[model samples]
Target: MRPLVELVGAGYAYEDGPAVLSGVDFGIAEGRALVLLGRNGSGKTTLMRLLSGGLRPGSGALRLDGEVVAHDRAGLTRLRTAVQLVVQDPDDQLFAASVEQDVSFGPMNLGLPVAEVRERVESALSALDITALRDRPTHLLSYGQRKRAAIAGAVAMAPRVLILDEPTAGLDPDGQERLLDVLAGLRSAGTTVVMATHDVELAVRWADDAAVLTPSGIRTGPAGSLLADPELLSSAGLRQAWAPAVTSFLRTHGFLTANAPGPRTPDSLTTWR
Candidate 1:
């Protein structure tokens, strides 16, 4: 599949700060899940901001559908409609009086008809399973509820690509699982999902592909391949994801053949022959 977004030799740096991202070549394919895996300050957020048009790259190219992203007014407007970024913090994104109002904000900003905006808001709320909270005040929602509401806001925009920065940051285990289910539903419905995180387990189990941001630059590959490389993981400031550790243990005990496929999740270890 062709990439919905591509970064070719992209580089960026805050004023007077050393380059946070440099010489990066990457892509997020349409209708797929891509995990941006890296340690804190590994440029994951920077790359995400670049992708979402929040920050322009200081070097190289940022492209959407093979065309360079234009920085002019009309271009930027279209780009915003095409791609939406959900910040890591729910508090940063939600400010409207009520959940429905907050979720309606994006489509309304697009000058959509009131009926269409209402439809989008309802759909988004239903998609995130937060319809019951629609009339509630944003301030009263729990962290998980607020996160879902924030995501509903973005979903209402109906962007071709959804970029999430550290989506699992504050969720409990159940919250994380619910969020993952929503993301999986989005991917199945052909929404391209790109999420930034340091969680190797999430990357291994959820992403169709992934990219690792290292101090040196960015490395892109299949999620499993990247998770399996201990040296690369260490260099990138990541420990081996649990699936691989369990797979190794099973293999060493002669529980599986040398040519057996690796486990994608820790739970799959028991199924190895």
Candidate 2:
């Protein structure tokens, strides 16, 4: 399948600041989840902003669905509708008085009819399992509920690509699981998910592909391979998905096989004779 988005030789930096991203080349295939991993200030958010056309690259090209993005009113509008971004803080996105109103905001802005807007809002809330919160006040909702509401708003826009930044942040384990299930459902329905996160465990379990933003540049591959490489993980300011003990034990005993699949969880390596 053709890629939905591509960054070719992209470079970006804030005015008078050091380069956040340089010489980056990457692409996201339609209907696949690509996880972006890096430490704080490693350009993860900057890259997302660039892709969503909120910020232009200082150099090189960014293309969406095979067309290069230019910094103009028309192009930015097109980019916004084609690629929607959900920020780390749901509060920043959720400003409507009620959840239903919030979800309807996007479609409304698109000049959709009342009927269509209602339909989109309902469908998005149902998909995010936030239907019950439709009548609730946005400020009254819990953290997880607010996050889902923000996502519902984004989905109501029906963007071809969804960019999520630290989506699982500030959530409890149950909240994380709920968000994971929601994301999985989106992937099943053919929505491409590009998520930035520091949670290696979540990336290993959920993402099909992984890209690391290192001090050098962006490196990407199958999630399994990227998660298994200690050197790459370290360079990316991340840790292995499996515990150090398990990694060391496997290495010391020669049980780590070249052909073995990357370990998905801490307990996944346990094999009883």
Candidate 3:
């Protein structure tokens, strides 16, 4: 499948500051999940901003569906509608007094009919399993609740691509699992999902492809192949993913055949025994 969006040699930096991202070349196919892995200050957020139209690339090109992205008001507006970004900080994204109003903001901005906007808002809230919090004030919600509300706002926009930065940063384990399920549902519904995170285990289990951002550039490929390499992980400031570590342990202890299929999820580990 052709990529829904792509960056070719894309580079960006703030005024007089050193380049945060340099020579980034990657593409995300429709309905797929891409995990961006890096330590803090590794340019994950900068790359997300470029992908979401929050900032134009200072060098190279960014394209959506084979066309170069335009920077004009109308062009950028269209880009925003097609690719919605949920930043790491929900506090920065959520401003409305109530959850329902906040989630409704994006669709309503599109000038859709009231009924359509309402339907979208309802669907988004239901998808995130946050309908009960619809009328609650944003200030009263827990951190995870506020995060879900922020995601709902992006979902209401119905973008082809959803970019999330450090999506699991503040969630408990249960909340993280719930958010993963929600992301899986969105993938099934044909929304391309791009997530930037420090969680190597999450990337191993969830990503169709993985990209590791470094100060010099990015290295990207199938998730399994990339996560299985300790050298690569070390260079990217990440450890080997959990599955590989477990598999290696089982192999050294003669608990499993060397030809066993690599397990991507913990549930699949039972196959080895």
Candidate 4:
């Protein structure tokens, strides 16, 4: 599949700060769940900003649909319509008094017709399963609810690519599972999902592809096999995800075949012989 968004030899640096990311080449393919992983300050957020048109590259280029993205008003407006980014903290993104109001903000700003805005808001709320919370005060929402509400605002824009940063950070296991279900629904409906997370286990189970930021630059590969490498994980400041011990035991004990495929999620192990 071709990338909906791509970065070729991209680089960035904050005023006088040493370049945090340099010589990076990456892409987010259409309709795939891509997990972005790295140590603190690994440029995961920077790369995301570059993709979403939040930041212009200091060098190289970002392409959307195979064309270099323009940084002008019309160019950005077009880009914003197709790509949306949700920050990690819900509080940072949520400002309106009510969930419905907040969710409506993006489409409203896009100058969409009232009818279309209303339709998009309703569709987004339903997609995120937050319809019941529409009239609820944003301040009154729990962290998880606020998170969903923030994401709903982006979804209302009907983006082709959705970028989330540390989406599961504060959630408990159940919250994580629920969010996964919602993301699954989004993918099924044809939106490409890209997440930046530290949870290797979640990446193991959920990502179709992964891009890890290393000291040299960026590394991209199939999530299952790539994340399973301890050296690679360590180089990216990540600890082991799941357990190699259990997998090794299963294989040696003949409960799993040596060539058993990843992601090797629990369900994938249920029928191993």
Candidate 5:
């Protein structure tokens, strides 16, 4: 099958501004997750906008399922519908009085049937486990609740590829866990996910492929390999997951003769002791 999305030599810049992205290239396959890693102002957001068809590239081309996406309104609309973007700030996305209304907004705007819209709204709320908040006012909810509502809104559109900007930002431990679980569920259901995050731990824990935007260029590889390389980690402004740090600490303290292989998840760290 063709990749869900591909960027070939894609570059973008604001009007008369310096180039935010240059010579960018990557491909996201169906049913796989790609995490965008970079420091602030490294063009991650610009790249996400390009992929979602929100912003056309100034140079080069972006393809959706093998078709060039440029100067075609219908194709762009279809691509936007298929590739939904969840903004970093939920407040900017949620305008409806209630969570259900907000979630249904996208499908309703697309002229979906009333029953289908309701079903999508309910299904999205269920997926995020926020069914209880469906009737609550969006503004009244906590930050985490609002974030989940924003995600539910995107889910209601039933996008094949979900692009999330800072999905784990400003959340407590519980909220982070909840959001991560939601993302994992989406990936398991074959929804390709591309999330832009500065959180190395989240990327290492959740993403299969990681791409880092740097002054030199975009670096792409498996998350594990990238995290294990200290130079790459520093260059990308990323740190190893908790388990790896603990393993290294144990080795330094002579608790282990050699640094053991790091555990994949935090829960698995308990077995190390």
Candidate 6:
């Protein structure tokens, strides 16, 4: 089956800078949570901009459902309807005074009817668990609340794919847990989520698939196996996730069987052993 979105032999470079990405092939499998991992300057954000229509690929093609994506006005409209990207900083995305108005902006701009727009706003607010803050001022919201508000704006678009750059960045542990729950709900509701993050633990715990950006190129595979590879992690300038370490220690000491599946979380130890 064709991926919902794909990049074929894609390459990108800034006006006068070296190519940040080259000969890349990426596919957004429908209904899967994918984590993009790399150190700073690995082009995760650049690649996301390409996926969301913010930046056109400098070479090769980006495709939606196998057809090459067009960047014209109508083309962009169609693309935006299918994909939405939330950046790292909430302050950069939030503008409307009230949370309701902020979350309503995207759907409203889509020219949805007031009732439909209201419904989407309510739904997104609920999905992010910020419905109570709907009437509150955006400026009055905490950093975590603002982040959810920004994500809620994207959620209100009802896109097929949502790409978030560091969704949990700047969030406290409780906030991260809450955001993870919100993400789980989104996936269960059938939205494909792609996130770029430095958190290997979160990748191991939450992602179904993962892509690691290295100087050589992008490596994509099952998060469980991919994150277990210490060499790959080191090459990508990422630390190995602790779950893999625990899995290794257990198996080496005969606490767990060698045939056991790679652990996804700390809780998996209990389940596996």
lDDT of each: 0.87, 0.86, 0.88, 0.90, 0.85, 0.92
Q: How do the residues 119-158 of candidate 3 rate in per-residue lDDT, one tens digit apiece?
A: 9999899989999999999999999999999999999999
**Cα displacement (Å) at residue 246, model 4:** 2.9
lDDT by residue for model 1 over 59-136, one digit each (tens)?
Answer: 998888889998887767778887889999999999999999999988988899999999999989998999999999
Candidate 1: stretches off by over 4 Å: 250-255
Q: Which candidate, 1 or 2, has the higher lDDT?
A: 1
Clashes of each: 0, 0, 0, 0, 0, 0
lDDT of 2 by residue, 1-273 (tens): 657888888998888888888888878888778999999988899999888887898899989888898789888878888889999999999998999999998899888899999889988999999898899999999999999999999999888889999998999999999899998888787788999999887887788899998888788898866777789889988987754435556756888764544344656556521
Against the hidden reference, what TM-scores do the models get? 0.95, 0.93, 0.94, 0.93, 0.90, 0.95
- What's the residue-level lDDT of 51 in candidate 6? 94
Task: Output the number of the lDDT-best candidate.
Answer: 6
Better of 2 and 5 by lDDT: 2
* lDDT of candidate 6 over 104-165, digit per residue (tens): 99998888999999999989999999999988999999999999999999999999999999
Ranking by lDDT: 6, 4, 3, 1, 2, 5
**Deviation in Å, model 2, residue 63 alpha carbon:** 0.9
- The residue-level lDDT of candidate 2 at 42 comes to 86
Top-TM-score structure, candidate number:
6
- List residue ranges in candidate 4 displaced over 4 A: 243-245, 248-257, 261-263, 266-272
The better candidate by TM-score, 2 or 5, is: 2
Worst 10 residues of 3 by lDDT: 264-273
TM-score winner between 2 and 6, please give it. 6
Cα lDDT tens digits, model 4, 124-146, are: 99998999999999999999999
lDDT of 5 by residue, 165-272 (tens): 998899999889988899989887778888888888787777788888878888888877765566666776666666557666777788776635755667886675
Extract clashing residue pairs from model 6.
none
Among residues 3 or more apart in sequence or in different chains, the pairs in candidate 5 whose N, CA or C atoms overlap within 3 Å are none
